[model samples]
Target: MNEQQNKKKWLRILGNIFFYGALLLLLFNPTAKGWFLRQLMEVGLFRPQIEQEAAMPKQPAVATAFAFRDATGTMRTTADLKGKVVFINFWATWCPPCIAEMPSLNDLYQQFRDDDRLVFLFINEDADVQKAKAFLQKKSYSLPLMTNTGQVPAQIFSGTLPTTLILDKDGNVVFRHEGLAKYNSASFVKQLKSLL
Candidate 1:
């Protein structure tokens, strides 16, 4: 082959190698990082998320409700809280997935807060009033809130924490979450909007 043709062939081969190698790297490291960095994050930073969910509320938690306040000053009772979609999330201060997922839940609630057809009652499984209050204050959460304070048993929880329990308008538990869920996830919003 001519010298120029050979040189062109070499350039094309090198270009193909670079392109295919980059594609392979992307395929192996789906976390938008290098494969090794992704693996490091999974083992280091992301492990806490998994560990937190694992440590979250387990055992049964009762379905009873107590009076609580929403973002507004109005009093809210379980009975009064019914209708539309009721997402009763029972979480504690220490649950990793619970904390990770609350921001999403808060966003979801705010998006639908003005809608009269929904109630996102984030129930605290903690009996300690002061601690719960401090935690809420620190987070600056303003959603409708309540606490069991031992009126409910852990046995009522289906032995899982980080469960986002969705109730129908009738207050029946429709869906339960046992893991981290995108608070404003498309599927979650769609399900909630559908119920409303």
Candidate 2:
């Protein structure tokens, strides 16, 4: 074949390859519902939706400031707990999960309460002082009980009772558990012990 004719043929092949590749990319782009597009969608939006869903996210609120006063009117500022490992558990007087887990919670608190490097917060979610006080008296748990005064600190509860958050010494949330946790579950205990 003549050199000029051969050159033209090679050009046509390269042009076809480039054009087809561009068309494939545009056709399979996100919003096209194609497999590649679906992957892109999952990476761009769907994945986060699943991760940030109402379920327990890995990290809870650690850097945010939250305050609640003890029944005796003493103030507890979350900022003050920054250098310590902090566990904030949200409970309500009427919650069975909260009641059932009380003993274990107390045990955990007692073991770590005196440790200046660790702090535990038993935050009651909108539980009336009378009811909470009555229950605490019956349980004989000396841990401080602080009720939610209306503003949520981190939405850690997502408006539900019995959510728990664990913060590291640096004030970064390392664990978040939603719902009633078996206070002594191996996984939970392991995490707690690791913090200590």
Candidate 3:
């Protein structure tokens, strides 16, 4: 009877240690937090709030032009992508929310990467662009990284960590979502297809 009580006490102690260790990892480790958030997305918790067709802009409202440089050091502007549906996401290396949504973005990108009608600009807000690139490489994500070259218009970007903007073929902001969202949903794919 005494041995059974001792075993029970050890089991409780081990359980407490495991629980606390996981809690600490979630709180302090961005990767762990991102993984946890991604699990929430897998359960459809962070679904994007895309507007319906009626709510979409009847007349294409001209979106603000922003300049950025791609990983290849090629300078590009929003104006340059006027005839294509442009998908832009502003994210940083240190942001857990950005990390959480990256896998979904990658999935979405993979679906449309070879399409000439759409352009995806994953603008990294990290101070060290190399770190952002390294993170993407480590995660085996094929997202094209771009860095801000000049002041991004407030209308286009409000300095949000995980802000996403979708521009129609005419360079109009058709959809804008701020915060982590699962972008690989069938509804979102259909909306993008409709725009194309």
lDDT winner among the candidates?
3
Query: lDDT by residue for model 3 over 33-149, one digit each (tens)?
Result: 999999999998978755653366533444468899998999989888989989999999899999999999999999999999999999999899989989999999999999998
lDDT of each: 0.60, 0.64, 0.88
Q: Return the top candidate by TM-score.
A: 3
- Give the worst 10-residue stretch by lDDT in candidate 2: 45-54
TM-score of 1: 0.57
Question: For residues 119-168, could you state the per-residue lDDT of candidate 2 as single tens digits?
Answer: 77888864467777787888798777887655555544577766777767
* Model 1 superposed RMSD (Cα): 11.6
Q: How does each model score on TM-score?
A: 0.57, 0.62, 0.91
